[model samples]
Target chain A: MKQLVRTIVLSDSYAQSSQNSPELEERDPYNRLLARQRGIRLPAELIRDNALTVSGLLNPEIGGRSVKPYQPAGYYQHLNFPRRKYAEDLNENQYRRGLYTHWQRTFLHPSMKAFDAPAREECTMVRESSSTPLQALVLLNDPSFVEAAKALAAESEDILDMFERALTRRPTAAEVAVLEELLASEESRFAADAEAVGQLLGVGMKGVSADQRSQLAAKTSVARGILNLQETITRY
Target chain B: MNPYFLDHLKRRTFLENSFTGIGAVALAGLLGRQESLGAPSGIPEAKSGTGILGEKRHRPVKVKRVIHLCMAGGQSHLESFDYKPKLAELDGKPMPASFTKGQQLAQLQKQAGKLKCMGPQFEFTKSGKSGQEISNVFPHLQKVADEIAIIRSMQTEQINHDPAHTFMNTGSIIPGRPSMGAWVNYGIGSEAEDLPGYVVLTSEGGGQGQPISSRQWSSGWLPSQYQGVQFQSKGDAVHYVANPPGVSRDAQGELVDSVNKMNRLFGKTRHDPEIEGRIAQYEMAFKMQASVPGLMDVSAEKPETLERYGCQPGDGSYAANCLLARRLAERGVRFIQLYHRGWDHHGGIKANFEKTANLVDQGTAALIRDLKDRGMLEDTLIIFGGEFGRTPMAQGSGRDHHINAFSMFLCGGGVNGGVTHGATDELGYAAMEDPVHVHDLHATMLHLLGIDHLRLTYRFQGRDFRLTDVFGHLIKPVLA
Candidate 1:
């Protein structure tokens, strides 16, 4: 049994493969060969952890009690027994790993649920992976993701640096073109509306300096696009 | 003949020989473009959003949708719909031992031998043309008694709050069965393109509110897509339905477009079907952002209509949820469940029940009337009940949980209105005549929606599991 375990663990089949093969190629039906790379969307916890790690906002303390990150206001409005108003963790615990997020069985963190995390009412043998609009909504608009994008923007030197930090690779020319256009449009919009800049930067626990608001907001939009890219959240 | 040609000839011969059989015809059509055969007679062609069974159903469809008003904490039948005059006569007297012996009781088990009868806390007057006896606590409901059919002999297996809710919602005491809403949505997919098929809304006030677990709405072994999506009564109806603060609608649209473009570029090289699915989901998410705010905004409703429901829009009360249920029904959400969680009264039954009833009474009646006014009630089934009923025996100022007998009412969706069906014993201790189990209720509900309870089976873990779980008898007499 030990020999079988070691052999399987050490096999070439265990190696990561790229998902860059051309479409419509005939391949193994039962997937006996490694075949074209198939990506597993990271689970809810790791999805958040990846964003925090890349943004340099992750509080890497080994272990403690669960944390409460940025969830929408009144997300637990329907919960009762003893009615509660969600008070998010104000300390560095706010940036803790998703594994440490407080688990409310009735109302699990919305982002976690959107990413198909189980409610923990029953033992989960396997977590189901679904590509859903709710997941897209979480990635695009959830405060946690938005704040991470803002933090990633604040820390990075430029758009290319943000791309490297988020995706672990420099953007292709085509990708760079799309992001640059987004950044330019967003910068002018934020430049005209000072309120918008404050709204964007006011999402997380950290506050932005007065002079850097407009620049940070535009870069945040670029950072957000990079974080939401399919490659950033998938493991091949 | 060549061996390959010989095999082809045999297959063609077999197809010609079994041409009368539907399967053979379908197989032959698949083998070649046999357009002349078309679909077999009596089989409906599949349509989008019609779920697993497609356009075909085991029976003719009666209701297009269901609105379940779940009184989450167990309600007292004695005070609500069942008028137990005999039990009232024995108020403060010792409960008959014959009925108490070997019976399961929740919380009142400690006072087993010392139990006393509690009289109905409210008055039940005969109402409407059919003279259905209803409590004064639900005055608005009494006014519409003619539109409802009351069943006073509803029985369940689980006696505790959580398990009873499980039995009521999933027709099983076990934790992991698909809820009835999930089953209905699975059987008949949603008509609302921008909204989920099954939606849950909850509110609590006036009594001890029990905690409701998300498990009650889970789809179990069924695909997660069928699970009930809970819409918050306050703030955004759906979490993340609103765009982030700095992101305007047009800006968000731009972001969605760029993301989809990147995804499509990725899809050109990779053959993952999930990429395509993600693209579709992104489009749907964009649509939801545009549609949900409009759906939740009840300001367009006339003043009198809002007045009838006794709520300001977005108050997160049961009344507000009832109004929202109507909107959801209009948008064609397949199953809408509203759980009012203030009915778990262990003390102050008289005051608390009245308070909770007031919270739901006008809204419940108003929803029925409003739907009727709009000509939608005929095809909309409305259910109003709780997981179980409170006990007949008194525990301090309130009652314990009872599973043997309870009451619920069905309205619209081809129910024989203004009638009472089934009965509890004289003491209101057990279901005595024409008893309806939780499974029976589920069966009747599916029957109304044109599903054969036995036929709507999902195979999981090498066995065929059904909502009724091998036990359900349609309550035929209640059908219109």
Candidate 2:
């Protein structure tokens, strides 16, 4: 199964753009006849796994048991029988594959839930692929995503280098300009309020050093936006 | 090919083959196209902040919103609403052979082995100007007794909890069907762009309330977008509603804008509708960041108001959820469902029912009062009931699951208040009057919301599926 997945993903068809001819679209819009490769969103597990892999935080161990990553507080109060309380595995466990994240049958992790993970309470034949405001929320605020951006920012101080490290391509000039503007704005904002910057750095499992906080914050912001780019989450 | 295998109709194949369903067909016809260019992923998106479907009411809407308070483990009609005085007289006696004739009892015959009549575990007294009979276990609900339409003969096909719940929620005894809330949202698009069209909040108290599966809120074959968005009472009202701890709102905003820019660029190149869906979702998430906090912060209400519903801010109590449901309705959520678990009492109905009842009664009553006070009641439909009723026969100290007949109550603008629309026999065992099946209840709710139950259909697998399935009556007397 692993080999099959790798070969399919590494194939030319997998790398083809979802962009296609209107004539083909008019003929087989759903690509039901396999007229062209379709651009589909990454699955819930792949999304997080992609982030962790790109961030260099991924611990690629073969799965054995479920691992708990940091999630929003009080997520499982909806389930009872001895109400559940999530305990974070902040070590290598937190950095494991997204598929390894512990899935409580009643309440899946919030990050997984936001990205359309099935609760697995019943046999799910086809997982529903959906886009919701919740996904944006998760991308912007989830610790895993944020930390991945932080690690990408830490990968290099050069913004262009960071882009290549994260997306594997030099960003277009226009995309670079967008990041530069965001970095300049974030730099001034954080410089003005060091305490606020400190507060931001204090959130999740790891914190960066204080001396380069503002630069790192700005880079982190740019990296976050890059990570959220459609191509980053899209295979093609 | 074997007939069953020949036309098995893999769901995806069928969906892709018949791309022409609603207005997409009209658009395809108008575009000088002889062949279909595929419809936008029919992922049930609310138009802007409105709901996904782009149509108006089929009739004048008497009620524009509905709150389904699900008593998950069937709350017994004998104790809660249905008044059968003779059951008390016949307490501790084996059910008359005549009453059990040709009857199939779940748990009673399957587990307990025999059936014995159980009396009303609580006293029923007349309350309100209409003198509606209510159990002593619910003094607070009694106060609003005049505001409700109680149906005593709601029946279903399933006898077990899971199937019974699936039947009550999705109009099917099988799993993988869009829930009634999903149907309502898909048909009527939401009035609020910031919140989901349909929202589900769950609270369990009785026993481990019948295990609730996500399937209850699944959109089934409907576009996944229409599924119920379960809101949590904590850190973020929804899983990702809040920005991660360190990210500032301004930074997040900039990130979203850039992301959208990239997404739009990709969308233009591919012309995929999923990209547009993602864009809308991001915008909705941005708006939700503001709207949800304000909505979930029920602390904004006065001290007196919180006390009325017995609510605690940030607590996942049924009371807090009931208050939240009203808040959601006020904010343009088209359908809000609260699964208040722990009502199933197969044993110790006398002991466990009261505990579960107390968790919901004050809040349920307060939601109606708050809506009426705000002058929103006329447009808000309130429904309170469970998958089925508890058996009239005693087991240990409780009753088994009874699919034969149970009671449900509807209130708010369209309901004919203080009226009892159906009834059970003197023993509270079987329907003797108007039998209001789950389909009938669904039909009446749709009617109140200005939808013709027959007209609001979603075609799937060469057939149009409805919340009422192949059954449903308008329940005319249910209307005011």
Candidate 3:
């Protein structure tokens, strides 16, 4: 048998040649280290061969150690919503949001008509498809969507007020105009009948002595509507 | 591509161009062959819709389309169409041993009360030139009797509600199978490019029982892409298709175009049908944003036509659905299945039948008459039947489940009209002469559609399955 002598060496020149240029110098310290690790260029082909040979030597039965059933290739981090402190302690805002949470059966959560989400899950793989016009009409006229739109407009007003309180400057004329039109349209559609408005306000046709409850309810809808504005919903 | 030798080739610099061993030579040869070989016959090239399968054979003699009206639950034949005077004579008497001997019992009275013979609850009179006996419950159907081909000896395998409904809709006692509409859709690819080939419309607002489920229109074993498209016909018909607030029509169009571009970018590399399907769906979605509103806009229909069918424009009623079905048929939908439940009447047979009759009789007749006047009846097939029929004997002066005998009718689509084929016994208990099984009816339906039921097969799980799986024979006597 002949014995072979092999010398392995690491050179700075080779390492420098393999290093990738940084995307930006302004990257955070943690990101910079991660970028350096990612940019380390090695001959993957040679590394793979050496790995196989080393693995084969360590576990001689076949080649390398077999994967166990319990060990996964990678871990997945799940996103979860924060829990409320108490079930009965929910305010009107929280209650309204919860009630508006739609139980969408076949597709993504339908945001109010103002958001323009798809009606159902669209299967992309097959050529054949069908959709009814009624869906579009429904979205245009549904009371649920109308209420959501109104809430969104009111939310914008609240935001503008908050901005004035914090920044001490009013929202631009363009922004205010858009918000006003949205609010007006929503208000007009919702005010189709005075009886309906009375019902929503939770008040009787005849004035009652303790009418503060009805006034509060009516005010809450406007506040909630302001909260539901596109500006409020979208992350600008 | 050759994993074994390629693994060694990458590491062995000395063996780069040298064919040192039989393994290297063999592997290289295999890799070369793999790249050069063309696609097999089973899988067709993408984008060319023709390749998924062979071109569907549509015989010139075949009926163009079908509109099936399934009255869910059992419709009492004696109270509706199959008027038996003999049952009137045997009223209040226990069914003689001669009558009850060979029949299968679905349910025992549980309380051990003797079954009493019941006569027709409503008066039956001869109507039309053919003098077909129709009960007063279906005055409108009686008017169109001459144009109808009634089959009074219809029998199905199952007796229970769910299974019987399943058997009638899917040709099997099992819950999952391609429905008759699905089968028709598969046989003929589709006529309308925008709409689905098979459509289901149901009116569940004022019915007595549960509405027909989407399962009845499922394309089981076939791709979910082939399932029947359901139309609610009222309110917002499609779910979630409204435009966003402040988004103009042009802006929405641009957004759809952007989405379509993204789809095309992802779809270009792979030959997946799903990606292709997505591309097609986007185009439809954009067009539907305009067409669907127009399609459901029944204001174009004249006031007289609406009055004839007794339909309201936006109300989601069965009568409106019938009018919609005719419109869909005109739009070239291959198959339309309409279901109206609540025919199961064990008591107040007269009143219940009258209610059901009033709800559907005029609308159904109007559909046929309208189709005929428009010259669509020649190409469109019409079929009306229930899951099964009710018993002749009264279970408290009414009827119980009877799956052994029933009545169903078909018209137009080259069928011999003004004729009654097959018959029930004098008491309407069992299929006595020219018996037509549910399988046979399925076979006949496919036959009318220009498909050879035996030949139309879809291979699944290494076995060929058909609409008339393992059984069926077309009744030639009913064909013109």
RMSD of each: 9.2, 5.8, 19.7
- lDDT tens digits, residues A85-180, model 3? 221212222212222233233322222211223233332222112122222222232333333323332233353563243224465655455434
* DockQ ranking, best first: 2, 1, 3
Question: How would you class the docking of model 1?
Answer: acceptable
Candidate with maximal DockQ? 2
lDDT of 2 at B44: 33
Chain A TM-score of each model, in the order shown? Answer: 0.92, 0.87, 0.25
Please report how far candidate 3 places residue B371 from its true position, in Å.
Answer: 0.4
Two-chain complex of model 1, DockQ on C-alpha atoms against the true structure: 0.28
Candidate 1 residues B255-307, lDDT tens each?
88888777766665554434554665677688889889999877789999999
For residue B401, model 2's alpha carbon misses the true position, in angstroms, by 1.8
Q: How accurate is candidate 1 locally (lDDT)?
A: 0.80
Interface RMSD of each: 10.5, 5.6, 18.1
Regarding TM-score, does 1 or 2 come out ahead? 2
Which structure is stronger by DockQ: 1 or 2? 2
Q: Which stretches of candidate 1 lie over 4 Å from their true place?
A: A1-49, A59-135, A153-236, B1-48, B245-251, B257-283
DockQ of every candidate: 0.28, 0.36, 0.03
* Model 2 Cα lDDT, one tens digit per residue, A1-236: 99999998898766656565667665654455545665557889999998888878889999599999887766665564567788899788888998898877747787787666777655655555555667777887788888888887777757888777767887777777777888898888777877767666666577676478877777777888878876778765
TM-score (C-alpha) between model 3 and the true structure: 0.62
Error of 3 at B386 (Å): 0.9
